[model samples]
Target chain A: MKMRMLLVAAAAILYSSSSLLMAEADGKWLARVPDEDKARVNPLAGQAKAAAAGKIIFEENCARCHGVDANGLHNRPSLRSERVRHATDGQLAWMLRNGNPYKGMPPWNSLPEQQRWQVITYLRTLPPAGAAGGKP
Target chain B: MFASPAFARVLSWAAVFLLPVPLLRAQEKPYFVTYSTDLEEPGNLEIALKGLTASPKDANAFFSPTMELEYGATAWWTTEVYAQGQATDNDSTVFTGFRFENRFRPLPREYFVTPVLYVEYESVSRADKSILEVTGHDGISSFQVNNSQSHPIVEHSLESKLILSSNFKGWNVSENFIAEKNLSNEPWEFGYSLGAARPLTLVASSQRCTFCLQNFDAGAELYGGLGTRYSFGLAQTSQYAGPVFDFRTPAGVTYSFSPQFGLNDNSIGTLWRFKISYEVQQIRDLFKSPSKRNAQ
Candidate 1:
């Protein structure tokens, strides 16, 4: 009886700890950024209005697959980490204009330039990976 | 004795003049007059002609304003007469000949293969006569005595065609393989086609152009045209020659137009052609619903 109780207690602890670890892993994965070899910009600084407009544009186009809050979806990379934080606005602009064809992303150069900039601005506001309820 | 360049030029001109006038007359019809290049096999006109030549019972089986008559006396068939006076004045041509057709079944029907055949013959009368002839008694005498007299020469032909067709889920697919001999005196030519079609936008009063793979002999065809009211289509044949345009107006009539343009080699001028057609209502009704008549 004693041994059985001990085994049950150990199993419960193991299950809880594993659940916590899985939650942490999910957050990290969702917050991981793309394109690490780029400079960073504070999207919140002088372009708050642009970023606000960008949020709307991003939701209209990118959010369908990228997730509502810019958090990554299944197989899509997050924008919270060093890679996204360090990317230059121009680089993001380029990616938005001419999408990665090989990656099945369609070019949005046909869209207005202001709209492209707005998407870039919105991408900058996503919280980093481990924040509560910030990522999947 | 040698013929000088001057003499040769005169002879050539003489030959061209001496050649039958009816040959040019036959080709003088307006470009819009429909002409199917498939002369070896019985074309729609030929089939109608055959029906007309048959007994009155066969005549009842066919009804068309344009009529033709053909007859074969022996194992070899002879004579093809086409008459269309509705759009012209006293214009018709008769092609008399003996044709030999031998069909060979190399594969089973399950394989989608059918019997193939070869036909060779000499077309006679004005239309079949050569465009050029030899001049002078000496040249004429040589031509008369020579077994290979080029004038009124034999036009040889051999054709192999296989047709496979099937229908699935309201869509139809037809494939055709054809090979011809003596293309402009060249060795032989071959072509194949696969066509698929399906109807879209089913409505009581909707006009939709059916999509097909081989509509214009191309791989894919989408039928929709200006204002979503008209149905227009562009297709490419399997040979990838070029796109052929087909259109239908809101009147529920169908038409096909092939635009051809090239440089006239002799005149160094522009050569252009625009063909248009309107199917007779009787024929159109037979193929489609008359309530949905559209323009071509």
Candidate 2:
């Protein structure tokens, strides 16, 4: 039991460090957003139906990189992380519109504005990091 | 005085320099036609070397080797340019010509049946037996004659296709309705192509492996000539069906191969085809604004 607890602690430290590194890398990407854009609110906020529709869209497209459960894959950040949870709806929307190509996240501009907002609504419903299961 | 061997050497060297370093988000397209709903990410360039060989019954065999450069101009628009050349047994090798092609998707998101418009302008010699397309080519004798080394008919033609594609349960199906018209005043010719494909695995593995079957896709293509405007029907048509495979490396190089069999006398039997592609830099990053460069 003691060895298992030590291993868990190590994994947690690794996960936290990786997340910090990712946040540092993404700082430039987030900085591009205007102050107004970051503060914008979701027009379709809390719409359960839109979120359901967005779930389908996300599964079709985003699931390849983000994983079927929106947990993330191949070093891709988990959508349920504190960073994603803290990002404003408008900021998230702006990131979707203008992707950080340098970092490999493609712009979601091809999706309709309504669909983008719907995806944001769906994202808002995900459990925060460590709420359901801890990931490293 | 370009021998096939010498040409091969030159092409191999060119491919070495043309192979671009891999980028993170580059998605490898699995098929030439019956394209997946996924589009090339904007600002990326992909290069491909495609080869196809056809042998008609008791006739001289011929093959086409083409080099293609593709650019994603936007999220919905992709453009490509091709340099085509051909070689025939007992015949002289020749550089047929080039073609420019574009594909555009109008819809922003997934639809019931996503539609893409394809247009191409080709300038090739009659001796060009690449058979990249099979339109209005229906006579058993036509294959032998069309591929005759003695005849080099220069043709400037416009080709168009309406591509309708859909995806369901990880399966992608696409159908192309084709139309071609010659600048030399020939009647419009029609053709069709259908493709269905799926990845070997729908789930990603925790460990990345270059030779993993999960990184590969298996598919099939069926295409044929639909006769010309002046003459319509399958009475004189060439049809081909084939199984295709694609292997994508982690470094962004994709290799594709196909073995096509003729379904009719008008078509050539046991045609073998292969293509290798590499992704280049995104156009946006290649030509970043001065302000962005400074910011970086």
Candidate 3:
């Protein structure tokens, strides 16, 4: 009995440490993506096709306030920013799956993975700052 | 295209009937009217009058085309070639010349309070010199012969303007200053203007009506006016010459008619004038989109 209890304690400690390590690694990965290819990589690599698909999703879901180009009309932050640019694919997927309670960002879990990716791909095409040439 | 038959008829009737009402109630608006027996007067009266009479929508829509070419010989200074012209009432004038505007600001925004120094050599010429000379005087040449009577008008002017804007609930206040001098003659003139704008009601709607009051020259001139800026549609205002009483319909169209009265410069008698304008918006959407190529 004494040996069993010792073994159980050891196993619990090992499990907790592994989770802590995993969390740290996730954070490191998030940090690396932003600092690494931010200025070098073209964020809009496959966006043209993705945006075409995303436009349908945007019109159906987001157009009431965000307008056509994701340029918010009233009081919404434009998707054209470093915040969106730095968001990892997984982070975007998670945000779409799980809604933020504090802000009005709604949970879009009902959307399929392909549709969510389409939206993400389209948002990536938006300039991280400044207005476009012929924006209405 | 959207003006219905009944609506068009009603608008025509309103224009006919309300046209005289503005003249009768000229004291309640923020516009003054002056006439010119000689069209070639020194001031921008023609442009100002035309702008005043133009439909607010159309006036805002027009680009007021301008082109300027300047050369700077030194680092801190250079010469500037300035040319600006606008056509209205089938007539226009081009003012072309050079100006030396010095750049000195204690603080960039402080320019609002301090005057900007400008020394200019300009040639103001009529768009139709032949017509003007024939109608007004004989043997009046365009550039050479008109030296004595039509010499280049040289001006050294220092202008300062201030605009303070804030909103308390629904009220906004703005102040303007304009001061200038004729370098050669040393004739100095200054004007101060204060105005307020506010909404009339708290209806949660896209359309907004703003009423403004401006007192000019320290109460020497007073003007009160109302305007409504619409969303999602076009309002075209007519381009005419005179005072303007402007109003916007619920359908996102603007109409302005004004009767003007003011004391003549000689203080001899009050001047009375009439003007009308129609505001049209969103007319550009009817045209095809332009090529996206950048100019060289």
RMSD of each: 28.1, 14.2, 25.3
Compute the lDDT of residue B265 as modeled in candidate 1: 19
Q: What is the fnat score of candidate 3?
A: 0.00
Q: Quote the TM-score that chain A achieves in each candidate.
A: 0.61, 0.77, 0.57
Candidate 1 chain B, run of 10 with poorest lDDT: B50-59
Greater-TM-score candidate between 1 and 3: 3
lDDT of 2 by residue, B201-292 (tens): 65343344677655688889988899999787776888888888888777667778999898987778788888888766433433435664
Give the runs in model 3 whose Cα sits over 4 Å from its true position. A1-69, A72-136, B1-49, B52-158, B185-187, B199-260, B263-296
Model 3 Cα displacement at B125 (Å)? 7.9
Q: Give one digit per residue, the lDDT tens place, for model 1 in B45-115.
A: 11221101101111111111222333211111122333321110122222323333332222211112222
Using DockQ, rank the candidates from best to worst. Answer: 2, 3, 1
For model 2, how does the per-residue alpha-carbon lDDT over A1-136 read when each residue is reduced to its tens digit? 9559847854463344333223322546666778998998888799787777667557645765566677765455678877788888988888886655445465554455666787888888788767765353
Q: All candidates' lDDT scores?
A: 0.32, 0.69, 0.31
C-alpha lDDT (0 to 100) for residue B260 of candidate 1: 25
TM-score of chain A of 2: 0.77
Q: Which one wins on TM-score?
A: 2
